[model samples]
Target: MGKQIQLQDAAYILKAGWKLFSRRTSLETLQKDKQYREFIRHNEAAGRNNVSDEGKRVYAVATDEGVLFFSDSGKGMKTRNSYLQHLADSFFNFSKGVETLKLYEMEIPSRQVMELADNSIDKLAKSDLRNAGTQLRKSEFSFTKEKMAGKEMLEGAVCTDKYDLRPDYNNFDRLTKEFNLGISPRNYDVASLLYISENGYAGHVVADYFHPFSYEYEFRDLAEKLDDSIKARQSAPMSLHDFGYAALQMEAKVMARDILQSEFHITDGEFRLSGKANRTSQRTKTPEKCLFQQSKEPEPEKSGCQAAKHVSSVVPQKKEKKQLII
Candidate 1:
């Protein structure tokens, strides 16, 4: 079996696939294309429409290059939905084979994040803190029960609201007050938002301007639950926003699979590259091993019979027909 691709590498592959596919097509073209329109029509007939009351639509097209998906809400509220479009733009840029820093790789200027946390804490009235503490204690009881049952203790396990421990706002405030004491900005890592779709396909994006909560040791489980909640809303009769997000998640999986299949055979979620695919990639990169390259040394002449044998070995010969005995 081929070595399993790390999630980071998989993200790159998916990004490249989307860029290539998007270059070959656009959202407008896809909306007008017969195949995509037909797909939407079929879905509508099946009582799963992608159109929203606001005239926004989310759709996908299957092209030879790969599947291209789009969440198009025309020109009016473009600014409001620009975040979604920015993700597509980022995918295209990342696929340009340039050295672009990914979200997690970028050094975040944590001053803004710290300030934001501090301001939020300062705005919380004493009554608000008491209410928040009451909520956390209520949530903690259920979370503790789930933890005792060996469910919510894992690092990255998805837990519902009933099973998740609400962030202790009071603790968060205490930590913020002591932030300058020993906590360096470097102490925090950017949290990644992981999503598992309704179809059981998983994808993740690194948070751009956010870090883990000051009081939280790890935020993976929280991010996962947030993702799960978002995905849970992406169902039949979904809003335009939800439909678009769902389409993007589904498209990512499709593009990833397409890329993997070109280089590797997938079986039961395992990937294995065939010998021919591996050799072809290697030969293309190594000039001396290229099939089109000619040998530098002259070949020795062969006898006519030997030449004939060589030709027979390389080329297929017609089979002789046997005479039928009546």
Candidate 2:
């Protein structure tokens, strides 16, 4: 009953509708990038007959759709499985820290994903560095082999673009998990974290830290947590990087403690916290507040020499532009 629209008019209308429906965003920033991707898909689709059993198609490591680009010069192969595995191994390394529990992991299922999304919609949400390795990426830091040692310890500058060092879905998983079985030398039973990197290039390492102890940074506040951080440092051997790691631990522990002290109306030189609050202890001492240790390096305690050596090997060796801050 309607007059037929011209084909040209129809095409124009459809194009406009497409544009409206698909607004440009971070993922759709470039037309060429997606085109290149489609072109590859088309060719691969046209011929699978010549493909061997071992041949596999790799998808880009991504947060969304178009954050990564596939290139041959990639430092590591672009894939979800390999990079995540490496990161998991690194995180689950019981050799470095006091293993409260064996780090175990399984592939996340769709149900968990949906549950997180549904719960997050109800709430406002919430939401390193390295020594060695070419790009010592961290949740908040980066450094190189050269910068990781001595008084010259330095963290590379932060990157502007969103780039993931590796994929780790459960950075917090290690904290809660516990070893059920009594076992010595957990070589095979440790867990892992898998991260899909930002630049599309993906690789992973064992979740190891510069500090040897399985120190946690999560505290109620800075001041409340510093005393415990200092205590943790006392457990560590004296080393070039150990000092820096200790300083970091102290800062995190102390910052939380300060907030707690404010709540209790406590002044300097007096500390008190118990129960769950005991997790974050405040230092009544002034020295605990100081971040820089005396230049006189602490002696290397040989009691845990094997553990210390193992932790040292996990550090990467590279000249990175800076620490990759997440």
Candidate 3:
């Protein structure tokens, strides 16, 4: 059983909708700040109901146990469905580095629930965060707005508690086979693949969805196979947080590859091979070897007057503490 403990890590907000945006605070700052903790507790309790539907934002708080998500649209299960949809949507967006997937249209079947469980297990195996169980709650809609003619509205909140599930499965084919998700060509696999690529090959497979382009299929297939091969024998499953971290990593890799190819003549053939070799050599260096290998001359020491002047020029003033509008 996972226990709820103070979220002592760095805090960040990842918002999804028309666009994706993230806000972050240092671990030291977030943990020491009384107001921030209060704000999270308040929002977890009543903030979803207090805010209007139009003003409702879909976001996640990366926590010690798992991602804490808030969704207030209707009571009980409805609220859980909404939150789960947004959760998948957020994962898709993070994986692809864009908000283009039609998340509402995608189905969240029993298989997906299994996927989520498997992914969570994998995450727990790789880290200490999930040792504490997660909290989930759902409630009836407390506030209402003028109904738009005949459109129905949902209300409530659901917080689902998850224990640190033992990640004993690592085979994607075997695990996926355990769930009978009647196949229909859907982009959910695209989202998951994008997730795997961004995060690294956790025990997940690319869905057998139709791809409009040959190159897209090739790219995604290669990634899928490669990831599967790498984790074929691993025991502990990947962590859920790795998906978040992996997305950022994938973003960086894509950005770097594009920049390198576009700015420098570093694409394909010769330059790419040379660059790969260069990187390989760099990775092989030990700290002691690297220190001795460097041949740059030391700069002349600065006088007391120069040092004092430099210090005076670079010193920074204190910043005022910020207030929250909660």
The top-ranked prediction according to TM-score is 2
Q: Model 3: per-residue lDDT, tens digit, 128-192?
A: 22222122222222111121111011012121121111110111212123222121122233323
Q: Which parts of model 1 have CA positions greater than 4 angstroms off?
A: 1-241, 272-326
What is the TM-score ranking, best to worst? 2, 3, 1
Error of 2 at 310 (Å): 22
Model 2 per-residue lDDT tens digits across residues 240-316? 33434334444443543443344432222122334222122221211111122335465432221111010111121
Q: Cα lDDT of all candidates, in order?
A: 0.26, 0.26, 0.27
User: Model 2 segments beyond 4 Å from truth?
Assistant: 1-46, 50-83, 92-218, 221-250, 253-326
TM-score, per-candidate, Cα-based: 0.15, 0.20, 0.20
TM-score comparison, 1 vs 3, better candidate: 3
- Displacement of the residue 191 alpha carbon in candidate 1, Å: 17
State the lDDT at 75 in candidate 2. Answer: 22
By summed lDDT, which 10 consecutive residues of candidate 3 come out lowest?
A: 304-313
